[model samples]
Target: MLRYAATRILFLALGLLVASALIFATLRILPGDVAQMIAGTEGTPAQVERIRSDLGLDRPVAAQYLEWIGGVLTGDLGTSMLTRASVAGELAAKAQVTIPLGALSLVIALAFALPLGVVSAVRHRTRTGTAIGVVSQLLAAVPVVWAGLMFVVLFAVLLGWLPAQGFPRAGWQDPVGAIRALILPAVTIGIVEGAML
Candidate 1:
């Protein structure tokens, strides 16, 4: 089992590396200059050139990719062009909100979906089971952004039941207040997970 798990891990890592490389190549293949795009149209030629040089965009594609992968290995994702802030830092901050919301939503999804799916499978011909299957399929078809915005409108805007956004830190007087902020986003993600399950 241990060896099997290790082999699976290695294969998954390899697949991810391959997928990343393919995506990088695809982006390069697309029209438009990436450096120029980063520099923006308002930037002068000198500014764009400087930005390209700063990003090592003058290097060959393979060299650039190698440098990028090396930097990623060293936990350097480069800076955000607009904010001039470390992308890794921004990601870490976002992850604080996103990770917990994802975990909670996944728990909610499993809590509902597993038993529901089992019931649907067992009582395949029953009206209630068919309804569950239909609802799941319909939910699976709904766009995530649409569902998120709808929840925001319903819970935060119209009903005034939950706060719309931003999380309270664990050190706050009401540490659990973050979940109130998280409710809509959690349900939005949970709906998709439940449908897929």
Candidate 2:
């Protein structure tokens, strides 16, 4: 079991390396100069060249890839080209919302799926069981984005029970508002996930 686990870990690392390389290669081949974009239309040629030099875009492809991949492995996600902000910091900020939303979604999915799943199993071929099965199938078939939009229309627009978008500016400091904001989105994700469960 220990050996098997070690082998699996090795494969996971290898897979990640390959995937990262492919992604880097794809981005590198895409049209448009990153420095040019950052400098904008009015930027002089010398200014653009300086921007490229500052970003090390003047380096060989291999050297750039190695530097990027090294930074990633070291938890240094580097700076955003446009904003020049730390990518890691941005990701951490986003995680504040994403993590709670995911946890709430899981709770909702289990709360919904467990009881109904048991009921459907217990009733087997009965009319109620069949109906539940059909409903579950339909719910599962709905795209998650579409479900979110419909939920926004019903719960946020028509009924005005929840905010359609944006988290509380005060974050968890405003607990009630934060949870309220998440409800529609969580329900949209949870219900779809529940159907699959």
Candidate 3:
């Protein structure tokens, strides 16, 4: 089990590395001046050039990648290119909402999925298995937006059981309201994702 866990951790790291490289490559290869985009309309050519130099966009792709990897390792995401705000702080704030929602969604998904998957695999030749498979496929094909909309309509508009949107702006202060607002959307995402599993 230790070996298995280690293997999974290694694979996860490898996947993240590959994904980061792809993102960096895509940003570089995409048409248009990234420095200019970052500088926006207020910047002169000189300002843009300075931005590029500061960002090390002037560096070779491999060098830039290494710098990025180093920063990531050190938890230094740097500042926002546009606003010059702390990127790490912004991400940390956002994670409060995203992390809880994700956790709830994962729980909801697994609640449905584990049993459905077990039953489906166990009874593959049976009519019940066919029905479950068909339902899973149908749900998987349903776009997330459509699912979210349908959920909002049902629970928020019709039955009035949950909030449709406007999650508590109080941030973590109103934990109850925050969790309540997220339930419907999380469930929607959960069902859709669980269908794939």
Candidate 4:
């Protein structure tokens, strides 16, 4: 199990690196100036030039990429152009919400998919298995955003049972309150897996 985990981790890291390289290349190849994006259209020529130079946008793309990657290695993602704050800091703040949502989402997906997959495999020739497989395929076909919206309409708006969007912390003073807030979102994601299976 430990060896399998190490292999998975290695592959996951390589996947992430490849994805990041693709994203970086896409950003570089896209038709737009990063300097112009950072300094708005209304800025004076002198100001724009200064900003461009400051951001190293004046440098060759390869050089700029190396510098950016170097900053990332040193734990500095640079500043947000709009916020004028550290990008890493903003990410850290936002991650609190996003990370839990991601973790909860993964747990729910696995919990739903694993059992359904096992049942479907075991009951391969049974009518119940065929039905489950069809439903799973249909669920997989539906977009997550659409499923989330439907869930909000049904439980949050129509039934008034759960909160719609913002997530409450998992360890909120009242565990029940946190559960109430998360259950609907969890169900929405879980149902997608269940349907897909």
TM-score of each: 0.75, 0.95, 0.76, 0.75
Show where candidate 4 strays beyond 4 Å: 1-22, 168-181
Q: For model 1, how does the per-residue alpha-carbon lDDT over 1-197 read when each residue is reduced to its tens digit?
A: 99999999999999988887888778777898766887778888998888878867677878877777788889899776557799999998888788888998998789879999999999999998999999999998999899988988888899999888657756235656876878778888898889989
For each candidate, C-alpha RMSD in Å?
Answer: 3.5, 1.2, 3.5, 4.1
Question: Candidates sorted by lDDT, descending order?
Answer: 2, 3, 1, 4
Off by over 4 Å in 2: none
**Backbone clashes in each candidate structure, one number apiece?**
0, 0, 0, 2
Q: In candidate 2, what residue range of length 10 has the lowest lDDT sum? A: 163-172
Considering only N, C-alpha and C atoms within 3 Å, which residue pairs clash in candidate 1?
Answer: none
Residues 1-197, model 4: lDDT tens digits: 99999999999989987887788778778997767766788887788889888876777877877777788889889886556799988888777556766677778888888888889899998997998788889899998889999989999999998887555555456666766777777778777865664
Error of 4 at 138 (Å): 1.9
Q: Write down the TM-score for model 1.
A: 0.75
Alpha carbon lDDT at 120, candidate 3: 97
* Residue 180 alpha-carbon offset, candidate 1, angstroms: 1.6
TM-score of 3: 0.76
- What's the C-alpha lDDT at position 55 in model 2? 92
Identify the superior model by lDDT, candidate 1 or candidate 4: 1
Report the lDDT tens digits of candidate 3 across residue range 1-197.
99999999999999999999999899889999878988888989999999899877888999888987899899898777667789999999999889989999999899989999999999998999999999999999999999999888988999999987658889779988998988988899899999998
Better of 1 and 3 by lDDT: 3
1-197: candidate 2 lDDT, tens digit per residue: 99999999999999999998899888879999999998899999999999999998898888999999999989899999878999999999999999999999999999999999999999999998999899999999999999999999999999999998779899999999999999988999999999999
